[model samples]
Target: QQPVQSPQAVILREGEDAVINCSSSKALYSVHWYRQKHGEAPVFLMILLKGGEQKGHDKISASFNEKKQQSSLYLTASQLSYSGTYFCGTDAYSGAGSYQLTFGKGTKLSVIP
Candidate 1:
């Protein structure tokens, strides 16, 4: 099953810090992180494997706990461009290319200067 994300919305001023968490009931093969600007498609942020391996774009960082089947994204010293809705996608192992992802409802983050 997909993970549930907390805090449906958040408001922050520039340079503030925030944390978003994602957790699943089922075992996860991988957890993918993404951020969507108001009018833009979701952009990949990071991917964390069951073995604790991580990969993704620069400027975004995340951590995954295999045993807990959970992940958290850390946003530090926020920027104006960081304002957006964050989503965590969970992928289960179904063999080979059969893996699929389920996204959380999302956490809306707004940043003000």
Candidate 2:
């Protein structure tokens, strides 16, 4: 099943901070984070594996709690460039090498300069 993201929208001024969370009902093989700017395709942010490995863009960071089936994205000192919609995609391991991902509804963030 797809994960659920919290706080549909968030507003922040430059240099501020915010957090977007995602939770799923089923165990996941990996959790992927992506950000989409208005009128643009979603860009990869980060990925957290079930085994606790992490990978992705340099500026973005996220943490996953395997036992809780949840993940959180933290934005520090937010900037206008950070304005966008964030989504979390959960990849379920079906033990058949056919894992697939489901994305959350998304969290919209607006940052003002």
Candidate 3:
């Protein structure tokens, strides 16, 4: 099943901070965070594993809570360049020694001056 992202949209001023959340009903093997700008392909941000791993990319970070089947992305000191739609991709085992990825609807974040 696809994960669900919270705060479908958000507006932030430069230097502000924002948190985006993703949750799933089934157990997650990993959560992938990505950002896509206008008319551009999504760019990889980071990934958190089921072992409660926390990861960071520049000023952005994320944490995974396997027991809760949730993940959260943290954007610190938001910038205008950060304006984009953020998506969370959840990985699940498909029982064939492989995994499937399901992406959320995404959270749109607009950073203004």
Q: What C-alpha lDDT do the candidate models reach, one value each?
A: 0.88, 0.88, 0.96
Candidate 3 clash pair list: none
lDDT of 1 by residue, 41-81 (tens): 99988788898765434456788898898898888888999
All candidates' TM-scores?
0.90, 0.91, 0.98
Number of the predicted model whose lDDT against the real structure is largest: 3
TM-score winner between 2 and 3, please give it: 3
Question: Per model, how many backbone clashes are there?
Answer: 0, 0, 0
Pitting candidate 1 against candidate 3, the one with the higher lDDT is 3
Off by over 4 Å in 3: none
- Report the lDDT tens digits of candidate 3 across residue range 62-104: 9999999999999999999999999999999988799999999
- Where is model 1 more than 4 Å wrong at Cα? 53-59, 95-97
Model 1 alpha-carbon miss at residue 109, Å: 0.5
Runs in model 2 lying further than 4 Å from the true structure: 53-59
lDDT of 2 by residue, 24-112 (tens): 99988899999999999999887898875644354567888888898889888887899999999999976677998899999999999
User: Model 3's lDDT to the true fold?
Assistant: 0.96
